[model samples]
Target chain A: MDLFEHQGKELFARYGLPVPSGEVALSPEEAVAAASRLGLPVVVKAQVHTGGRGKAGGVKLAADLDAVRGHASDILGLDISGHIVRRLWIEQASDIAEEYYASFTLDRSARKHLGMLSAEGGVEIETVAAENPDAISKVLVDPAEGLTEEAARAWVEGANLNPAATDQAVEILRKLYVAYTEGDADLVEINPLILTPEGRVHVLDAKVTLDANAVFRHEDYAQYDETQPRDEREEAAHAKGLQYVGLAGSVGVIANGAGLAMSTVDVVNQVGGKPANFLDIGGGANAQVMANALEVINNDPDVRAIFINIFGGITRGEEVANGIIGALEAVDIEAPIVLRLDGTNAAEGREILAPHLNEKLVMEPTMLDAARRAVAMAAA
Target chain B: MSIFVNKDTKVVYQGLTGSQGRYYGMLNRDYGTNVVAGTNPRKAGTDVEGVPVFANCTEAVAATGANASCIFIPAPGVFAAVMDAAEAGIEFVACITEGVPAHDEARFFNMLKRDHPGVRLLGPNCPGIITPGECNIGITAGHIAKPGGPVGIVSRSGTLTYQALYELQQKDIGVTTCVGIGGDPVPGTSFIDCLEAFEADPDTKAVMMIGEIGGSAEEEAAAFIKDNMSKPVSSYIAGVTAPPGKKMGHAGAIVSGGKGTAAAKMDALRDAGVRVGLNPTEAGELMAEIVAEL
Candidate 1:
């Protein structure tokens, strides 16, 4: 899950990384109060999940209290990348003698945690990679050994940073690795890891994405999840532990896998019907799960037809048939159901559902046919 | 005739006492996998479903001569389970456990490369490999796979893999093997690995590779196909319109930094003379056409 800027900085501070002391404020008055407490010359950063915030005018430096108030009010409701700013992080501004970049992320091809350090920062890393690739020093960290001081020192030297910043960068790099691995973060990026004239290094900006799977270990991560901008249907689906994406359409989709679920939605659209939502039951099609999915879709007033697409793998087709039968008994579903069941005893499954076959609970032999049937039903 | 697994590959189950392990282990045995014994150190000597239970892979191997083992343990113990399997000299390991920490997967993957050179790992979050009418490891339903020797399949999603196989079955085309390399950000194997195996396999004629929107595995496989493959290859990429940031079910299914998009992957494969399908059904039809022409 993506963390807001204030949350990322808070997480960084927990790891003992040096972040400019910041206060999160929801209003211009709070921003001015924070500035007064931090003692003038603050930077107001809009707290949103997307990047290019500076270019989008979501970030500004305030030389005084008046500037902080003005910048905070201006950035409060600014929209950046479809995310409207609801909060601002007012931080004490720091002097920058030099800026550098450091990040840790999983490198899928290498099958290792990747660490990148660059002497040049405060710009897009992609540009650095494209224009002057050598400026960025890439390190593939063995998870067993991790980014040790020796390796980090070598990486820092490879980036060709100033000698004054070498030891400190290495120290900070080691801590960042701990923050990355121990924190269960998928990505941790510090842009403009600044070196001050006073010979101190501080984190100017932080971008953190925690592994959603690791949420089981971190309970406090729920607060971060609460910040996600999901519609009511998506929120309901999430609460029920189903993978769902809300869409503006009439056909409610339920499928077994992520890919197949997506394909089901696409086929629904291709066959001249809009998908109401994308719901994946993820290998299990038990009565309880089917009921939950049906109940969630039934709540959507836009849904005129429901497409139940099940491709049995480990799950037997008979079980899916039984689940659908039981779910129909359990939930008061409003829309007509069109199911395309196949694989793993699908004939037996079809035989079991044969008794309940009607205009309301219909079965199509193919995904294309099922989609078409659902679309036609919705249209009718 | 299959790529990695067949009737001859003896299997050991890790965490077989657990619900998922016991269920799939029995199903695999029922499907004609050479099911030997299972490992659960605490439940050693306990037999579930007539399959003997051993203290560890070491004991299981010494008794049953098992080479390939499938793990069904929870995520936390997966790292240790994989290491134990490798230490016991199991050459082929397929982990069905999902939610393994990326760090743990990296460590185990590195250890397998640096130390257990003989080990062939398939997945940490996969459906495993299947050879039709022979043996099935992982969670794939055996009835869906028809026994034949025309196409070899590789996919990152289990249900989608089954869907592609069913589509082939509907076309009266059966696969020599179907390998699910898994959908984790860092999988134990890659599309290129299975592609190379399929390219070398004598029974396999054409290949169907299914990938999602995450990672450059499809792009890398396209390069491999261009340079080395002699057989026809059909490609299907999922999540063509998936949002750039949101993960589409799989950990590896995220579109990051403008890369790993379905369009980009399809473009690369098309450039490499591969037949690209926008959806699974279309991809299945394309494979049928390729096989018919051959």
Candidate 2:
């Protein structure tokens, strides 16, 4: 789950990392009140999950209460890359002597936690990486060993950070690593980790992506879950405990695995049809899961046809066919369903479904054939 | 004759008392795999339908002479189970549990690399490995797999692995081994690991790789194939129509930062002289052609 700026700062503060004093404001009046409380020369930043917030005019420095109110109101409804700003993070602006970047993420290939420190910050790290790769100093720390104080100090010196902020930067880097590991985060980044004119280091911006799988360990992560952006269909699907991604196509796809579901979407598109959504039933092809998936897709008015692709592994084809039949009975589906069943006990599954084959319920021999039929049904 | 498992591989189950563990354990045993022992501290003296249960992996390995472990533990207990298997001196461990925290995977993966250099970990969220008809582990349907030589399959996706197997079965082609490396950010094994094994195995002739958008494992595997592999390879990469930044069912199947795209993986594979298939069926066909020529 991706946390907003204020939320990331809140998490960082828990690990004793230095963040600029900030207040989360949900409205223009709240923004003005926050700015008044924080004193003048506060930065009103839009709290959205996307990047390029500054370029999108969602971030503004407000010198007074009036400017705070104006900027807050302007940014609250503004869209940055389709993510609308619903919350504002109003913070006391920092006096920057130098800017640097620091982040801890998984180096997947190496199977270790990678810490990247760079003197050049306040810009897209990707650009800096592509333009001047040597500017960024990288350290791959084993999760078993963790980031040490000496290692962090070496990393700071390697990045060529200002010597004046070395002590504070090393301290903050250690704390950030704690937040990255203990907090169960996939990524914990502080871009523009600024050294103030007073020779103190502070986090100016935070981008933290927590691991969803680790949510079972942390109960407080529900607060972060509430902030996730989802449409009505996605919200409904989430409530049903189905892995669904809403798309802009007419063919509704339901498959047993993530890869097959994605392939089903691709095949639908390949056959000149768009998929309405990507829904993976996972390993289970039981009645409840199938019914839940069918109900969710049936609720989408844009869905003209449904493609049910099942290649059973642990789940047998007979079980899948029975689940689809049970789901059809449980849910009042409007769209036609094209199913292609294969793998274990597939003949038995097709035999059971043979009795129910009709215009509304159709079967195909291959996945490509089923996709073509579904696309044609959707077009018609 | 297979890369990882053969008839000689004595297997033990970590969560032997659990429903999943029992089901796959018996299935594998029935497939002619040397299903030897199981581990459950509580059910040490007991047995699951004939397979003896030990208190722990060390005890299980000690008593049954088991060198391989198939883990069916829950996600929360998976790390400990994997560590237990490693500590018990199991050389090959395949974890079938999904949703294991990435941090746990990274720690255990690195620990195994450093502490137990001889151990080969397969997947924490995978369908396990099968040396077609000889030995079966994890959840891949055994009846669909044709047992013989000349072909090896490795995939990141589970059901896609099954799809590949079924596709090959349709063409009357046999497989030496099929390995699912899983679709997680940090997998225990990579495409290159399986490719390297398949390349050295004399029984395996050609290779079929099913990859999706995620990490650079496929790209790296492509490089390995280009530089090192002599066997012909056919490839299929899913998520061609996947949108950027959206996690496509698989946790690792997201196209992020304009990287790990299907187009990029396909291009890499093609440049490495791999017969890239547009879809799973086409990929199966390409493998069939390779096997036919072989």
Candidate 3:
């Protein structure tokens, strides 16, 4: 899960990384109060799970309390690439002598933790990579050994960071590595890591993405989960432990696996029908799971037709068919469901559904046929 | 012969007393795999059906001469289970447990690389490998696979792997083996691993690869196919319609920072002289055509 800048900074603080003292504000009044507590010249940053906040006018430098209130009120409702700001991080502004960038993320190809350090900061790292790839010092750390202090010191020097800030930067880099690994973070980035006039390296901005699968180990991550962006249908699906993504279309897609669900969505669009949502019931197609998935998709008024595609792997076709039949009996579905069942015992599954075959409940032999039928029904 | 396993491969279950373990382990044994032993510390000296249970993989391996291990342990216990199997000197380990922490996977993956270089770990969240009518390891349905040769399949998704298998079966085409690399950030195996194995296997003629949005594994596999293999490769990448930043069920199936897109993967495969299909069904048909030419 991607953490907002404020949340990332809070996590960085937990690791003893030096960050400008900040307070989270949910309203304009709260922003003023936070600014007053932090003294004048505070940075009011919009707390949204997206980037380019400064360019989008969601971040403002307030020299006074009135400015803080004005900036907070303006940014609270500002949309940065469709993510609306609902919170603000009012932090004491730091004087920057120089700016540098540092981050640790998984290099998927190398199967190692990758660390990137650069003198070029306060801008998109991608631009630096595109323009002057040599500016960034890349290091692949072995997960078994972790990022050692000696290696981190070399990485800091390789990036050509300010000599005066080298020691502090190295220390922060080690801490950031701790936050990345011990904290179960997929990415821990410090963009525009500032060196103050007094020669102290401080984290000016933090971008951390925690691994959602590891949330079971961290109890505090529940707060981050609460801030996730979800629509009504998505929220309901999440409640039911079903993986669902709301899309803008008329055909509701329910598939067994992630890849199949995505392929189902693509096939629906390939046949000239947009998918209303992408829902994967996962490995199990038991009665409760099927019913929950149907009810969630059935709640979407835009859904003109529902396509239930099951290619049984560990889940047998007979169980899938029974689950669908049981779900149909439990939930009053409005949209027509075009079903396609394949894999183990699929013939037995089809036989089980023979009596239930009707206009509102149709079964197709192949995925392509089922997709076509669903697309045509949606169009009609 | 298949890449990972064949009729001679002896298998052991790491969590044999558990429900999922007993279910799939027996199913695989019933399909003619030599499921010789199972490991459950508490249930040691007991038996599941006719299979003997041991205290750990070491005893299981020593007693039954089991070379491969199919893990059905839960997420938290998966790391230790893999380590135990590797330490026990198992040749191949296929872990079917999902939701394992990435750090644990990365740690053990590198540990195995550093220590037990001979052991081939398939997945910590995969459906495992199946050499049709020979050996079934994880949770893949044995009936969907046909028992001959010419086409070898590898995929990142479980059910889609089954779809590819069924599609080939419909065309009266059989597979030498099907490998699910698992849809996680750190998979034990890669598409290139299976592709290289298939390229080396005489029984396998053509290859079918299924990929989705995530990482550069597919792109790298495409590169490998271009330079190393003489076999025809048919490929399909899912999640063309998947919006950026949305995790599509799988933990690793997401498009982030304008990277790992289906379009990029397809283009790379197409540039490598591989037939890239628009969808799974079409991909299967492309593989069938390749098999027919063979």
TM-score of each: 0.94, 0.97, 0.97
Q: Give the alpha-carbon lDDT of every model.
A: 0.88, 0.91, 0.90
Clash pairs, model 1 backbone: none
Candidate 3 residues lying further than 4 Å off, grouped into runs, are: none
Candidate 1 has a DockQ of 0.59
For each model in turn, which proportion of the native inter-chain contacts is also found?
0.52, 0.79, 0.82
**Top model by DockQ, which number?**
2
User: Which model, 1 or 2, shows the larger lDDT?
Assistant: 2
In model 1, which regions exceed 4 Å deviation? Answer: A28-37, A62-71, A345-348, B241-244
Query: Docking quality tier of candidate 2?
Result: high
Comparison by TM-score, 1 against 2, better one:
2
DockQ (CA atoms), all models: 0.59, 0.80, 0.79
For candidate 3 chain A, the 10 contiguous residues with the lowest summed lDDT are A282-291
Best by lDDT: 2
Give per-residue lDDT, candidate 1, residue A305.
Answer: 97
Q: C-alpha displacement of B32 in model 2, angstroms?
A: 2.2
Fold similarity of candidate 2's chain A to the true chain A, as a TM-score: 0.95
Per-residue alpha-carbon lDDT of model 2 for B108-179, expressed as tens digits? 988998899999999988999999878998888898899996789999999999999988999999999999
